[model samples]
Target: MTALVQTVSKSTLLSVVSAIVLGFGIITVAGHVQAATLHDAAHDVRHATGFPCH
Candidate 1:
């Protein structure tokens, strides 16, 4: 039971760390991308989700 608990804890920790790292990486990359690109991506997403951006 103790080993199972340890394994689960380790897996959860790894998942959390991975998510944090991926989020940070995306933010860093997005910062470097062109504003037009980001705007177009956002526009596409809004339309795709039926948000009516325009």
Candidate 2:
């Protein structure tokens, strides 16, 4: 932990920590969602990104 703090700038560390917290929160919320709802959301994202989900 000390080595990482010494090697990384404050902004970089802050960005990494923020991303980790956001990802964890998304996972936690998604776990409690209905399976059909999750699948629909993922399907919409895939289409939005021009990916072929079907």
Give the alpha carbon lDDT tens digit for every residue of 1-54 in model 2.
899688998999999999999998885444434467775767666557664455
Per-residue lDDT over 1-54 for candidate 1, one digit per residue giving the tens place of the 0 to 100 score: 678657677779789889999998885444434467675767655556554344
TM-score of 2: 0.51
Q: What is the RMSD of candidate 2?
A: 5.9
- Off-target runs (Cα >4 Å) in candidate 1 are 1-8, 32-54
Kindly give the number of clashing pairs for every candidate: 0, 0
Worst 10 residues of 2 by lDDT: 27-36
